[model samples]
Target chain A: MRSNTRKYRLMILLCIAVTFFVFILSISIGRYSIPFWTVLQTLTLQESVDTTIRSVIFEIRLPRIIAAMLVGAALSVSGAAFQGLFKNPLVSSYHLGVSSGAGFGAALAILLAAGTFAIQLYAFTFGALAVAASFGLSRLVKGSSTLTLVLAGMVVSSFFSALISILEYVSNPLETLPLIVFWLMGSFNAIRIPDLINITPIILVGIAGVMLIRWRINILSMGEDEAQALGIDLKRIIGILVFCCTLSTAASVCIAGVIGWVGLVIPHIGRMFVGPDFKKLIPMSAIIGANYLLLMDDIARTLTTGEIPIGILTSLVGTPFFAVLLWRNKVGWS
Target chain B: MTFETRGLSFGYAKDRTIFENIGFSVGKGEIFCILGPNGTGKTSLLRCLSGISMPLTGSVTIDGKDLHSLSRAEVAKRLGFMPQLHSSIFPYTALEVAVMGRSPHLGIAASPSERDYDLAWKNLELLGISSLAEKPYTRISGGERQMVLLSMLLTQQPDIMLLDEPTSHLDFGNQVRLLELLRRFSKKGFSVVFTTHFPSHAFQLSCTVALMNKGTFESVGPAETQLTEENLRRIYGVDLCVEYVSKANSRTCVPIIKNDDGRGVGAR
Candidate 1:
């Protein structure tokens, strides 16, 4: 019964509080457990804190947590925007073939390159290009044809995935193959401030663009013809949205590998709060998604002695959560 | 505002022609009915006049301006449209669906104004289903959905309205009720173009009737002049039966003439 602005504000407050709670828990729960007071001191760099606790918290946990939260927010927001654009609940931010495209890019990078930065760059560029190609091809075939777009996405995904496997078969098994496989599963580890610094602007700009056009996104969900009839140049709106979503999603994929279900699930979860209104759904998903991923990462690192791939842990957690949601609600594509 | 099409002909694709070299026009304050059977390019023609689709060989002008040249928002500002068989395709509420009609009035990145909500609510109230505004559009009855559609179009507040088979899905009572509403809309100098198969309904309500045969207009004129027994028999391929229904409080209509041998001519 509350107005949209009130509901939106309340959701934001809730997200902020939950995110703070998760941030505290994320720093405190690792193998080297610290007291709440010491964790606070370590965080605020209080004079009483030990050097080891402070170094461990700031150097190791903080960057990983930040990366997880950023990746989570990026994927989910991208997913939410994508689901709204296609008007299909099943589509994620990666539905435009970003994952396949990015994987192909990464494979080529590792195959040809010598180091970490080069590999990341390879995945980033190729992944983005792959998505761009898929979109360009879809545009060629899809003229007011939603079905054609879906079909074109499928064709592009299948083609790139094949290229990825082919690249996998030819690469050196000990070094490049494991890296590609691990990258495919996704990870969050050993990331310094530079990785964080690199993707921050892309994520921020993409999120801002989506938020600015959120109301127009609501009209876009009414199907393209209705949007056009209402004076929305659908091509223009869709063009910008695709760039925003694809950039965030590809950037997240660059850092996190292929963390599967955040994009697939975040928008659906956000809908439970606001009844599919994007003006509320997008922001809520971002906050919730950030917290959700950080929490999952906390569990992943804490439960195991050595680091488990974040992808493995997320799949282990996310699949069951998704199943419960689907069982409770009749999850139709529309 | 009046809308007139000067030789509007359209096609679905290069080889697939729906309309071939057609022309029609409507003046202000007139209930102009275009009567045609299914797939006689009725919907396509409606799209063409609404400026959603372009004509293949001719042009349609609205208030002396060419329809094809105007921006869609500009066209929408002056025109309201009701597409036949619009399944919501998502779980939008009747209110949400109706509010989308106001999109033409909003600038990019702008929320709808209070006047937009007021117009939608007023239209819903006029349609007598303001209480059902929060209901899911797909969950409503066929007739009720039809009324909701009309309410949405009315909310557009366009000086001209175009509908394809406006009364097709409603029951007899609501069908007549909506026809009456359309009559009133045209009477208020809001030019209205509607396509229907019911000749008698057109005869009772419309100021003009346009009968489409094959892909072109066979006849266009006042209903009494065009919708004759011979025309009905030829168009519908029925032996044209008309019945009179008695109404309340001492009212009677002329009895219909039946076939002398009681053998009605059956359509092959």
Candidate 2:
């Protein structure tokens, strides 16, 4: 696979093409769909547009699309980071319990915050801080390895989740249980223009920061001992990466209510498409992830009268894809 | 560039001591092999000298500058290190893996320059591994990967090279080839330091030897002086022999493993 550089190049090209196609379809899809031409015209800033249609397309769809795109990219990049840091191909933020930490933060915001935008900020803040604290703790302890980090993450996540569950159990079910349930299932419906604005800075920083230090990340995948011999500051680089991934995870959770598998599935997809170089995989993972989630959200929204939780849909769709990957490995093609 | 660990001591943590009061120096153009058995802190000494771990006491100075004074990147720019072996899961290409050595020259957002690519390409070509430039590093044989790693170390263009058993996982031919490469590199004035169980490699190419028995250097001298039969026996704690043998009537000295009986096992 590494020999056939052309294969990765082609896979990347095809993914880009497919993602753009899906992005166009995602823009056109929703509760009162616009025509493809109208969508295109609006994008180009043409005149004589219907105000209601314009609001629906620009205000509702555009923000949702961006949120989907950012979350998708965030998950994949973070997933890749965790995998590289741990030096295990199977590691992800969710499995490391970063998701539960984030869920706790979001729940805390939901339970305590009074305003919508403030809650999103609070969730992102607490979420990123929680995982950062776990990493910090792991660093202080003696003889801490990746397994130790994972164990610490799980413990931290469990403690927070238990607190969240206690909060849920004590609250009025009629008022709060459905809110917690819907939040757990995950969604893109709650995001507004203001919410997107709140999430934009951190996502922007993470996306750009990851791309900037992308090669360092690739070197880091070699494991810290070798990387350190090669002159990398192992702890510092790992810290920055953990921060970026935490921020990315937090922002995504703030908007999407814990969308699963975008991080898990997209990186492998990007790797399959682009080999292991983060220079290529990072961006492709973001784009493909964004488009995948957006397309899935469109399907979830239109497939039934009742909205499907995005977390559920991702698990349903991604598990089979993950199996296909395992099967492909068995067949020796991938 | 010379490497020296003067009265150096190190531990994994505050209480765990691996080595103590170690002192040795490598010349600017020499292969100084650290010869010792396991649990003698061979790897720990290398780690301390390479600046990967701080010496609990004493100083490691490379090229007249103290190791602690130099930044990690600064030290890395002049020194290249290779551990035993690493097999990557991503299956990077030989060129790609080699190109990673250019990291010291890069900043946050910079791409590989033309010079960087040239260094990578030239190193691969120099190792006679130009054909593997496009091959997956994982797909290659263990010996080939070792060659690729040599190419990677060469790509760094360092004046000082530190290796922990560079030929441990390699085959006999690969061992010779790698030792030859290191010899050639030393001839170009790159100081090379390595630890190994094989003394013939040092006897063939290296100029000096640092023999350790406990937690410190017990003997340090010219290769012929420090790697003698008696010294090697004492260091390795085994009966051994190093003698010239004729292959097709040509004379060559080979280190032959001897049993306790201390007799040549076959025709020599």
Candidate 1, position B255, lDDT: 24
Per-prediction TM-score, please?
Answer: 0.91, 0.92
- Give one digit per residue, the lDDT tens place, for model 2 in A1-334: 3234466568767877987778777888777888988888888888888888788878888888888888887888888767767766676656545666666666666677346666566667667767876887787787566667877787777877897798788766787667776877789886779888878888888777777778787687776666776778776777787777787788888778878877777788877766677767787778778788888888888899888999999999988998898778621111
Q: Can you write out model 1's per-residue Cα lDDT over B97-164, one digit (the tens) per residue?
A: 67778777777676665566677878888888888887778678877887887887887778888888
Best by lDDT: 1
Task: List model 2 lDDT by residue over B67-131, tens digit each.
Answer: 87987778888888887777776777788888888877787566566577678888888878889
Colliding pairs, model 2:
none
lDDT of each candidate versus the true structure: 0.78, 0.77
Q: Isolated chain A: TM-score per model? A: 0.94, 0.91
Residue B20 lDDT in candidate 1:
78
Candidate 1: lDDT of B251?
16
lDDT of 1 at A97: 83
Q: Best by DockQ, which number?
A: 1
**lDDT score, candidate 2, position A204:** 80
